[model samples]
Target: MHDGAVDLKAEARARIYAQPIEMLDPAQPELFATDAMWPIFERLRAEDPVHWVEAPDYGGYWSITGWNDIMAVDSNHQTFSSADGITLQSLESKAETARRGARPSFISMDPPRHDEQRKTVSPVVAPSNLTVMAPVIRERAGQILDGLPIGEEFDWVEHVSKELTAMTLATLFDFPQEERRLLPHWSDMITNAPGHGPVESWEHKRREIDAMVARFTQMWNDRVNAPPAGDLISMLAHGESTRNMDKAEYAGNLGLLIIGGNDTTRNTISGSVYALNKNPGQYRRLREDPSLIPSMVSETIRWQTPLAHMARTATADCELGGKTIKAGDRVVMWYVSGNRDASMVEDPDSYLIERARPRQHMSFGFGIHRCVGNRLAELQLTIIWEEIMKRFPSIDLVAEPDRTHSIFVKGYESLPVMIPSRN
Candidate 1:
């Protein structure tokens, strides 16, 4: 690490530790943007793995940082219910959401309903479909990479990461590929809050949602009227469990799918480049053995846990980590923190693409809500890297990334990069 970066991390640690433990609210979005959340998670994991926060805005929420504890909370969905909604939304935001369009995605539902609803869209990413999609991803990735101007600075996130994911996302919904840019924008609107990031205000966000609803609802109507097809919209339109869904439910599902299909993979694509830039040794090793693409993909997902946290409401009074979590209390399992737990992962902070057990991380949650599109995300990363290896020997990170300002979506907004020459 550079002397300045090391000093900044040390400063952040001191400042974070100087504050009282009880006052810590892990949901703060600003910390993630400035990349200061790492030290905060470091402190939380060390002192109070199962910590509590009683913020006026957030009310009371539990932050689970340890790997095993997070796994327990994630797997036992019955006790830690997702029905209240995920990602630690504030009371005001929750109320606003209900009034705005009631985006009640299946990911937030429990049991039979969640399973049935999720089942409708699972086929899009099935092994057979992923096989079909792999070559398409490679072709698009190659085209995107080829289009980049050599020896000139450009935002990698815009040119490659976002471009590839947006196309894939558009295909999954059978939406117009030309309008693929809207997919990531809608995903941003889903997680954005007034003043925190992309969203300017609740009204501004509501307007964005309105545009999304109009577009998605039109697609839903078109797909529902047509014969059953292979895309996600058609699957939901034809599936018994989803066909009768209400408007709000449909909007919710669309938002979830868009965000799910975009964020994790896009962020990780950008993160992979940044990680390799920082850990040049790993990049050198990878360039020599292109066979290590899969391992590198898994390691990048682990290193850049795109989703920071998923919030669950306790269904009943439960004992976790020797603490009593009352029924109805908000509990947030920090995937980002668990992915960095040294107890489970050796040298967790270090970015090692060739780790022995690279996929042993919580970037994709466990149990019923485990990411359905995980394999597709991996496939995209693997194919992109494979295609990239066949082109450029290295991508120069011109500057640090412009990260997203949300504790929910740990991602990049822009990553400036330059390729000096193609191999």
Candidate 2:
């Protein structure tokens, strides 16, 4: 662990037992970045599952730490609106985004409008579509694994995780394959805070987004002019509801699709390698029985919880888990914490690939807002692991992964690993 992580752990340790449970703040980004958040969540789940904390940066928010509580909040979309936002952005940042005229996406909308817009892109990842995509995904996964440098250290996040996801995302949008790298780049800029990770400033983020809109606008125009097709752009251009969307709405949906398509699966791919290495017994079981790939993929998603928390605004005063939330209060459902709630998941902390009900996870939000691309994410992960088992005896992690510096995206920036050459 880095010195920063050590300090955060020390701080958490000092606070976990010493401070009042109501005062403990689990939304601190450093805790997530260092992977030292488990203990904090564990403490919250035990002592105060519906904990409240005030922060100078993001203001006061309620942390719903338990699995059932999170499910309640996620499922009760009418009472907890996602329109104000689905993240813990600072009040200042929220005001600034509004000042700059932020657009609305289905993820941040409610009721009739959200449903109508979501249906536009739902078919892209439908079961029938995934069946058609399966072979293409497998072929890409094979090529990516075969191209890895055996017996040499390399960044797995870069070579395999990002590359494969980018390829799939490009195919989804029918985006230019040559420009596929931009998909992840835009996703990073959209999610990362300024002065952390790739984003240097909010201005830089704006410029990159402007470029993205320009590119997508051209695609939108072209697709609208042409006959209806199966790609995401074509779906949006020709779909009854989305066809008349304004620029802001179009850009909003594009950002949603890009991040949804890129980050969650990309991080899970990296996490699977790290998780398997950390649990060698599980790795051995996996190697011994490759049929466990599907279950293992679900387990990895639960263990990783790629997207940590989704914020919701209380539509009206309500009581939850013994705490009262007032109207307009920010209620954050910590999926990262919920996924590990021992009350719900058996031995939740351990990376047991062969769990009886591996698919019962909260990584994908529950109810109507559950991830539409979840099946596609699972497909990518399953294919990659199957391909990995076929080629390499083992992949050894050379160093600790460089994790992302955001609480929202539980992901690795890089994971150094080496694959031994076959004799």
Candidate 3:
């Protein structure tokens, strides 16, 4: 049956012969924030942790919510495969795989290939590399905060967080700063779900992807022929394992790098500002003690869960949390829900900046697929928060923030704020 005519609930039941499941209706985005499905998650964690969600509009799949179940799916690459794609629904799975093709990045690979490609860049993203980047990131953060106009309302998403993250990513890739803004736009075009952002048509999205691939193609040739000193592009271009990467693999890896490096970091920054604005006490506490920036940043990521759920297609028949899953069934690990898991996290509601388990969040994911750029993201966050506190001492939300309408990435699209001039 076609998408519109299919019964998602029945389809879900057929896929996993466990407790009957309810598909999350995309129509209600607030369900994510209102803790609507939370009680169900808590119930399942106590009972059937691997619950199936058969939702309409998007194709149906199983929703794995508990921390253990999420990790099981994340770590067991042999049983659960990322090669199918890493988001909800079979449509997205198929489209992404097809679009990615032989050019699949480490995000879409399993085992040996994943490990090799992941290793090539892991050192650059390690804590040591982040330490090197911290001051550079801090300097940029200060520059962005310094450039903000005093007492005037502006789009924080565009100006402060997005700009900073984009610039940093550009610097890492050695892309011209003026030209790097297109990276975010290209990422959105490739991944933005239906009914969100500027990716209005499939044809348009495909064309955009082709254009982005073409740009990367040229860059790849340039880097391959005349390698730079030590940028990411140069590393990819010259690395022994990555040098002979085919065209599709090269382009896909490049696209994955852009999205993985930019989106979560940018969104978390925007979300942190909104969170702090809503919780004045937490904001005050953070500003008063700039040392709390790291914990505060982790709290922001846990609170935002920016990367949302990542999908894994079952490679072998398996049973999980009392549910039987057939081979090839899509298993979506809901990081957003998992991050808020009450059993693993304390309270799970209050945005306390001093939460002791600061890095315990799943926003960067877990196990092998854990974010490679996590330290860089955190370093950038710390830098930004420190600069904001030092330069302005105080900031306030001027209006209700706007959120992007995508289930895969949770973040604000627009946030207006007022930063008083310290001068």
Candidate 4:
């Protein structure tokens, strides 16, 4: 860990325990960046599963920390609505984005509209589609692994995680293969605020968004003029539901698809490597039985809990966990907390690869807004690990990863590792 960050994290951990129960707030980006949010969540789950924080600047919100509570909010879409926004964004950020002509993506929409828009592109990841994509993904994973440098330390987040992410996203969008890196770059910009993640400033983020708008607009026109094809952009251009969407709506959905496609799989790739390195016994078990790859993939998703929380607004007064929630209150279901809720998951903290039911977790969420690309994400992880076990004996972590400075994206910005001699 970086000394300065470690010091800050230590202080935060100490403060969390010492502070009044009502004063505990686990939404700080700094805590997530330093990997110190665990204790806060632990205390909340034990003391107050449904906790409320009063931070006007960050948007005062209720944090639902227990497994059942999160499911209640996620499933009761009538009471807890996603129309307001998906993550906990400050009031100002929403206004600023609106001023920039950005609109809500399908993830932020409710009912009929959300269902229609989501279905338009859902075919790409359908069971039949996944069957077609499996071999293509494996071939690409092999190429990515075969290109790795042995006996040298490199940022795996950059060379492997993001590289493979960009390639898969490139194929999904039918973007130029050589310039595939732009997909992850654009994702980073969209997810970050000024002084956080990969974004340097508001101006920097604005420029990147503008560039994305221009390029995607050009592609939209090109695809609209031509016949429909297999790519996502083309699907949007020709699909009955999405064909008539305005520019702002088009941009919003693109942001959803791009970030969703990039972050979850990318973070989990890095997380799997880090988790295995931390638990050598599980790594040995994995090596002994390659069939454990699928189970290991699901377990890592639970352990990592990428994309920590999804926010909802209360549509009506409701009772949850014995607390009365008023209309229009910001309700955040902390999936990261729920995934590790011992009440639901047995030995939730341990990185166990061969559990009886590894997929029984809330990492992909629940109800209507459940992650649409979950199957594809699992396929990628399974294929990559299968490839890794076939080629290298081990890829050791050389140093601690630099985590993302955002509570919303539980991801790494950099991970150092070495492939000590390929098999």
| Model 2 lDDT per residue over 140-213, tens place | 99988888898899999999999999999999999988999999999999898888778998899889989999
Quick one: RMSD of model 3?
6.1
**TM-scores of all predicted structures:** 0.97, 0.97, 0.88, 0.97
Error of 1 at 86 (Å): 1.3
Question: Model 2: what TM-score?
Answer: 0.97
Error of 4 at 217 (Å): 1.2
After superposition, candidate 4 runs with Cα above 4 Å error: 1-11
In candidate 3, the residue pairs with backbone N, CA or C atoms under 3 Å apart (3 or more residues apart, or in different chains) clash, namely 23-54, 86-311, 87-311, 103-248, 103-249
Q: What is the C-alpha RMSD of each candidate to the true structure, in Å?
A: 1.4, 1.6, 6.1, 1.6
Query: How many pairs in model 4 have backbone atoms within 3 A of each other, for residues 3 or more apart or on separate chains, i.e. clashes?
Result: 0
Each model's lDDT: 0.90, 0.91, 0.76, 0.91
Worst ten in a row by lDDT for model 1: 1-10
lDDT of 4 by residue, 1-423 (tens): 458867877887788899898887778887888898988999999999998899655767899999999999999888899888899986667777776865678999988999999999998889998898899889999999999999999999999999887888888899999999999999999998888767888789889988997899999999999999989999999988899999888988989999889999999999999999999999999999999999999999999999999999999888888888999999999999999999999999999999999999998999999999999999999999999999999999998999998879999999999999888
lDDT of 3 by residue, 158-259 (tens): 888778888888888878899878878887886675456778766677788889888877777888899444677778888877888887788778878888
